[model samples]
Target: MEQMQIDPENLISIDFENGPYSKTIRTFRPDVYTEDGTYYALLGPDKATGILGSGAGPDEALLDWDKQLAVFISQKHSPDDPVAEFVFDTLGTSKKDVG
Candidate 1:
């Protein structure tokens, strides 16, 4: 199972037509993989609070994932928490950076 490890900022949006409307969707970090030539994009854990998309390739999987993300958000569901905080109570050398 190969994983995507690029910076999240490089992700792009995919445009598609829905009925008589046009839409664009962009997704954040999603677990991407392929099984028997089918590509899948998954966010979070389960269907209740997560989104899953599949396609013939990586980009297509991401595009589908983005579309699903939009739908989930429209229903007032969040796939992942966006808030974060870290208390710096002491001065120390850090070997890694967050965000």
Candidate 2:
């Protein structure tokens, strides 16, 4: 297996529109946005698989993202994959105040 490198210092923050957010998915809260009447989960950078999941409502969209995140982790994608890294980074940062 090819080794993947980790560049923690070089890691960058992902941008999401200041829209609705929810803590129902995983431990972290992913920003939710709507486009063309469909809600989407803003997972990471726009250029690379920006919107990971989409659905009719925020709850469904978040559910899809949670399932996608689990699949991504189970697949064991190379750490060099930005999409994977972005998903990890997004999930790692949780909203401390959320209950």
Candidate 3:
């Protein structure tokens, strides 16, 4: 598995993995929102290239969501490099709370 971190100031760090060599790509801008003093991370893969937002503080829920996404992609698409597009369409369109 590969890993990557995106440091975009206010946004939470996005750690992602594609395979053994492909690191999680970071976006320049992240979409962020606060709810009940908790921040949530949102990634608009279609609109933005990388992270859309990060939940406030340490968001286990969001992290889990991301992990699930990675797992799903790995299991469903395996060695595909462009799995992000499929993930974005499948998960992003559903607008389901990953966390």
Provide the lDDT at 58 for model 3.
42
Cα lDDT over the full model 1: 0.47
After superposition, the stretches of candidate 1 with alpha carbons farther than 4 Å from their true spots are 1-27, 47-49, 77-99
TM per model?
0.47, 0.53, 0.31
**Which pairs of residues collide in candidate 2?**
none
Give the deviation of candidate 3 from the true structure as CA RMSD. 11.1
Q: Per-residue alpha-carbon lDDT of model 2 for 43-87, expressed as tens digits?
A: 555514443666787767777876766665556555466656655
TM-score, model 1 to reference: 0.47
Q: Which has the better TM-score: candidate 2, or candidate 3?
A: 2
Q: TM-score-based ranking, best first?
A: 2, 1, 3
Clashes of each: 0, 0, 8
In terms of lDDT, model 3 sits at 0.40
